[model samples]
Target: MQLVLVRHGKAEDPAARPSDLERELTTTGRSTVKAMAKGLRLCVSGKVAIWTSPLPRARQTADILANAFRVKKIREHDAIAAGDLEVLASDWRDLDPQPKALILVGHQPHLGSWAERLTGAVLPIKTAAALAVDLDEDSALSGMLRWYAHPKVLAGLADR
Candidate 1:
């Protein structure tokens, strides 16, 4: 299966909200994500499932992707917000019909960690950046990085 890891778009200043989970995407962030989603749509094909952190920023990013891909359901899971790869793997194993492609939208550092774990590459996951990995059919944990795109690059691709 293909795994696409995305860092949530730029959000309000951390101090602007009492809870980080409540912080929302800035106007510019939303537009950037929309363009990035267009680029992402160009790269991925087949049925795709989107899972996102419960946090507002991540959820908003997932929403944009859902629209871009015309995906009907977006799963909101704590494992994504908590960045628990173990739980994510267990949940994925439990999927009734695993999708051909999966997109995970979440925060940084954690997303970067996941990329490193899956691809053995030290990736710098900037906000709104995305990395694609092809997971081993035998084990979800094992995969190779297919590509990594910064928000700027993806937005540029959207113009094509």
Candidate 2:
């Protein structure tokens, strides 16, 4: 299965928001994420499933991806926000009808850490960046990093 890890777009600072989970994506965040999502659409094919952190920022990002991918629904998974890599992997393994591609939208360090754990590459998962991993069929915990790019690069790709 192909796994796409997407960091949520730039959001309001924690200090400005009463709750971290409530922090909304800024206007620029929405625009950049839309561009990034369009670029991602060029790289993906077949049935795609979108999973997202429940936090407002992540959910908003996921919504943009859903529109780009033309997927009607987004699945909100707590593990993505909680940074429980094990549970996320297990859940991926247990998907009854696995999608050809799974896109996960979530927050910072966690997304970067998960990418490193899966591909053994310490990637800088910038805001609105995306990393694509080809998961080994036999091992849920391991994968190859097919590609990684920040929003600028991805947005550039959208033109191609």
Candidate 3:
């Protein structure tokens, strides 16, 4: 299985909203995410499934990805927001016919922590960052880090 973990793009200052969940991506954030999406689209092939947290920022990021990939629908999964690594892994494994690639869009520490747990490597995923893990049948935790890309790297790819 291939897992692609993505951190939500830069969002409005938390202080700007009473609730953190209400925070939306800034203009720069959207542009950065669009670049990241373009880069990702080049690498991804076949059927892809996208799951995202319900939070505005994550949903916005997912929307960009979905559009880039031309996906008909984006699935919302609570485990993405809850940041339960085990549950998220289990959910992925449980899919009847697993997708060729799974893209999960969510927040910071959660996404970072999930990547660490999966690959046993401390990967610092910045805003609009993405990490791709290649997992054998054994366990999600045993996956290997295939590639990691941030906005800067993706932006360079987008320019070509």
Candidate 4:
């Protein structure tokens, strides 16, 4: 199974939002995510399952990815929220047949930590960045890092 981890895009300044979960992506964030989405489109084929945190920024990022990937629906899961790695793993296990490719849009530290836990590699994932892992088994810790694309790198690729 192929799993893709994505960090939510740059969000409105914390001071500007009353609640962290209410923060939305900034203008630059949307543009960068669109470019990253373009690059992501080149990486997979067929139906892709998209799971996103209910937070506004994450939901917005998921929307960009869904549109780019032509995904029919995006599932909102509290498990995908920041710092919920264990829940995320459980959610993965609960999927019936499992998707050929799964795109999970969430926040930092957690995304980075999840990537490391899955591939056994410490990957620095920036906002709007994505990491692709190929799992030999359904286990969260049983995967190889196929690729890690920073938002800048993906944006550059989209330009090519």
lDDT of 3 by residue, 98-137 (tens): 9999999998789888777778889878999898899878
**Superposed Cα deviation of residue 121, candidate 1 (Å):** 0.5
Give the residue spans of candidate 4 off by over 4 A: none
Model 4 per-residue lDDT tens digits across residues 42-83: 876666999999999999999999999888899999877857
Q: Give a tens-digit lDDT track for model 2, residues 78-120.
A: 9998999899899989997999999999988898888889999
Give the lowest summed-lDDT range of ten residues in model 2.
Answer: 12-21
Ten contiguous residues with the weakest lDDT in model 4: 134-143
What RMSD does each model have against the real structure? 0.9, 0.9, 1.1, 1.4
- Candidate number achieving the greatest lDDT relative to the actual structure: 2
lDDT of 1 by residue, 1-160 (tens): 7899999889999899998879999998999899998998888889999999999999999999999999999999899888799999878867778888899999877898999999899988988999999999889898999999998898888797
Worst ten in a row by lDDT for model 3: 135-144
Candidate 1, RMSD to the unseen true structure? 0.9
What TM-score would each prediction reach against the true structure? 0.97, 0.97, 0.95, 0.93
- Model 1 clashing-pair count: 0
lDDT of each candidate versus the true structure: 0.91, 0.92, 0.89, 0.87
Which regions of candidate 2 are displaced past 4 Å? none
